[model samples]
Target chain A: MDTLEQDIKILIIEVLNLEDISGEDIASDMPLFGEGLGLDSIDALELGIAMKKTYGIELEAGDGRIREHFRNVLSLAALVRHQGKGSLTHTP
Target chain B: MISWDVPIVRWVQWPGIGAAELGFIEPLLRRRLSSLARGALHVANACAQGCPSATFVFASRHGELTRTVELLRSLAHDEELSPTLFSLSVLNAAAGIFSIARGDRAPATAIAAGVESFGYGLLEAHLRARKSPAKPLVYVYADAPAPDPIGPQSGDPQAVFALGLLIQGDASSRLHTAFRPGTMVGTPATLQANACLRALERGSADWTSDRHHWCWNLR
Candidate 1:
C-alpha cells in the first residue's frame, strides 16, 4: 500500500512484539483491535507513544476522536499522513 | 510433584542495578524502564515454564521505583523521558516477561510486600502448590536496593538478588515445611531469597541465621 500504511504497520509489529505477524499479513482495511489484530488497551498506549515519537503528533488527553482514526491500518495511515504534513519534525 | 523439604534446585543470584541487567523480572519492567537499563541485563539468562492449572508468584521489595523517580524527575523538567526506560519501570515486568518468554499462559501475580516480600511470596507459592496437586507452581523473588541520594539508610544498598522455586505435586518431591502466622523474626543481613535458599539447601528443619522466620523437615 502507501508509505503511511506501511510505516504504521511496521510500528504496530515493533511495539506489540507480534513475532508471527508481518506487514503483508495485515490488510489495509482490516480492523486492528478486535477481529483482525486483537490488540488491547496496553497496545493502544504503546501505539500512542510510537505515533508521538515517529510523527511528532501529541495525542491530547480528551481526543476521543482518535478512536475512529485508529480503526484500521488504512485509517491509521491516513491520519498519520494528514498529521505528518503539519506537525512532523526531523530531529537531527 | 516437587517437594518443599529437600532442595530440588539451587537458586542462582543475579546482581545488578536495574531491570535490563536483573534476571527474570525484565518483562514487567520493560514498559517503565528509565535509568535502570543496566539492571535488566543482569538476569537475562534464566527462564521458566509450566501447566495452566499452576499459578505463578513474583515478589520484589522497592520494585523499580528508581526508574519511576527518574521518569518523574524528567517530567518535572519538561524533558522527554526515554521510552524504553518508561516501559520497564513496573514491578510485574519480570513476571510478565517470563510468562511471555516461556509461552506459559498460567495466571500470574506480582507482589511487593515491603520487607516481608520474600516470605509472602513463598507463602503464596505454597498455597498454589497445595491447590494444584498435579502441576508445579513457580515462584520468583528479585530486588535491587534503592540507590544513592535516596541513601542506603532506607535499607541495604548494593544488594541485588533473585530466587526461583518450582513446587511440584508429587509427595516424594515435596519438602515438609512448618508455617507460623504473625511471627515477626529478626531481619537477615543477607537477601531474603538467599536466606530461604540457604535453609532449603542445607535440608535444615529450622533456620534463624538471617532475620527470617523459616522451619522445614525433610524426609
Candidate 2:
C-alpha cells in the first residue's frame, strides 16, 4: 500500500473514531462516505480540520467538487500527494 | 415552600463509568464529551430508552468546569482556544446531547443549584411538565471532580457518577420538599443525586440537605 494511503487511513480512523474498523480493512478504492465507511457530513468537517492540521491542506468548507477528492483512500492519497507542496492553502 | 414532589416513574443510574462502555458514542462526539457528559448521556439513554420525545432537565453542581478552566487558562496565556474545546465547553453541552441524539425538539434544560442541584432541577422539570402535561420528563444529574490542582481539596472524589429519573406524572402525590434558611447538615454526601437515590432505595421518609428537607412518599 502507498504510504499516503496508509497515512490517510490512519488519519480517518483517528479523526472519525471508527474503532470498529481497522486501517487495512479500508480498501484503497472503496468509497469513503455514505455507502462506504458510513460517515456523514460532520465527519467530513472533522476530516477537513484534521487534513488541514496534519497536512496543512486547507480545504474550502463549501467546495462541492472537493467531495470527489475525498471519495476513497485512493482519491485522498492522490489529493495529498498532489498537494505535496508540503504546506499550502487549497481553496476551490 | 421549596415545593416539588413529583412522581418518579422510572430511573437509571451508573455507579462508576469507564471509557470502554462509551464506544457507542460517535468518535466525533466521544472525544468532545467530558467525563460529566459521558456519564450523564449513558444514564440518559438508559432512562429514555422508550421515550424519545420526553423533555430533559440536566443538573450538576459543576458542569464542564474542567473545560471552562482550560479555556480560561488558554485566554490567560494569550493562546487561542481549540475550536472543538471552545464549542463543547458550555455548561449545557453535555445535557443537550440527549436532545440531539433523540431528535427531540422539545425543551431541554441544564441547571446548577449548589448542593441542591437535584432538587431544584427536579423542580424545574416539574414546572416544565406543567407547561405541557402530556410530555414526560427525564431528569439527569451527573458529577465528576474537576481536573488537577484547581480545586482538588474542595472537589469530590475522582469518581464520575450519574442518575436519571423518569417522571411520568402518573401519581398525584410523590415527593414534597421544604426549604430551611439554615444548614441542617445531612449525610456526608454533598451530591443531591446520591441523597435522592439513597432515600429511594432505603425507603426513607425524607432526605435532608443543608438547606432543605425532601420528603418522599413512594407508596
Candidate 3:
C-alpha cells in the first residue's frame, strides 16, 4: 500500500480500536460503513478529531461530501493527501 | 446456576501501578491462567483496546477521571501531556481496553459506587454469574487516589490495587455474600483491596475493607 493508504489504515485501527483487524485485512475499496468494516458515525467523529490533531485539517459539519470522502481507507488517504498539502497548519 | 464456591484456580495481584507494571503479574498466573484469562487482564489494563476481558463486574471508584482532570489542567496551561496517558484517561478506559483485548463479547459493566464501589461491583458480578451458569466471570476493581493540590490530605498515598476473581458456582467452593450498611472512620482501611483478599483467604463470612466501611459477609 502507498504511504497515505497505510497511514489511513493505521489511523482507522488506532482510532476505532479494531483489535483483530490489520491493514492487510482492510481492502482499499471496501466500504467502511454499515456491513463492510461495521464503523458507525461515532467512529467518523473520532477520525475527524484524529485528522485535525494529526494533519491540522478541520472537517466542518456541513461538509456534505464527507460520507464519500471517508468511504474507505483509500478514499480517506486520498482526501488527506490532497487537502493535507496546503490546508494543514499543525506540523506533526 | 452459577457457583461462587469454586476454589480460586489462580489469583494474581498488581497493586499501585499502570498497564506496564500490571503486565508483570501475568507470568505468575500463567501456569493456571487461561489464554482468555490473560487476555482479559491485558484488556483491563489497556482500556483503548475494545475486546472486553470476561469481567464479572468491574469497578473503579475514582476511575481514570484523574487523568482527564490532568489533561484539562495541561490544556489550560498550554502544556503538552503524554498523548498515551491522555488517551487512557477515560473512566471506562481500562475496562474497555480489557474487553477488546480479551475478545470477550459478553456483557461487562463498570461501576463507581463511591465507598461502596468494590462491594457493589462484586455484587453485580456475582449476580450476573448466578444468572448465567456457563462460565466464570473475571471481576477486577482498581483505583488511584487523586493527585496533590486536589489530593486527599489524610488518605494513603499509592493506595491503588486491583483484585481479579474468577467466580463460579459449585458446592465445594460455594461462596455466599451479604452486605450491611453502616458508617465508620479512620482512613477506612478496611476498604483496601488487600483487606478484602485477607477476608477471603481466611474464609470469613463477614468482613470490612477501606473507606466504604459497610460490612460484608462472604462464604
Model 2's TM-score against the true structure:
0.75
Question: What TM-score against the true fold does each predicted structure earn?
Answer: 0.55, 0.75, 0.54
In angstroms, give how far residue B127 of model 3 lies from its true place.
Answer: 8.8
lDDT of candidate 2 vs native? 0.70
- Here the TM-score of candidate 3's chain B is 0.67
Error of 3 at B60 (Å): 2.2
A16-84: candidate 3 lDDT, tens digit per residue = 667657889889889998889777665666677677667756587898988888888777777777777
Worst 10 residues of 2 chain A by lDDT: A83-92
Interface RMSD for every prediction, one decimal? 5.5, 4.2, 11.6
lDDT of 3 by residue, B122-196 (tens): 777777776765555667777656665577423222655566666654424544455544354454443545555
Every candidate's DockQ is 0.08, 0.15, 0.05
> Candidate 1 on B1-219: residue-level lDDT in tens?
123442233233355234333343434334333322233223323323324444567777777777777788879888666554466678877666656655567678888876667766777777776676566566777777776456542224365556666666564534565544323444344454555555566655443333345565444
The list of candidate 3 runs beyond 4 A from truth reads A13-27, A35-38, A85-92, B1-57, B70-110, B120-140, B144-161, B164-191, B204-219
Clashes of each: 51, 1, 28
Best by lDDT: 2
Q: lDDT at B169 for candidate 3?
A: 48
CAPRI-style grade of the A/B interface in model 3 = incorrect
- Writing each residue's lDDT as its tens digit, candidate 2 over B118-153 gives 777877888887776667788888877766556732
State residue B91's C-alpha deviation in candidate 3, in Å.
5.4
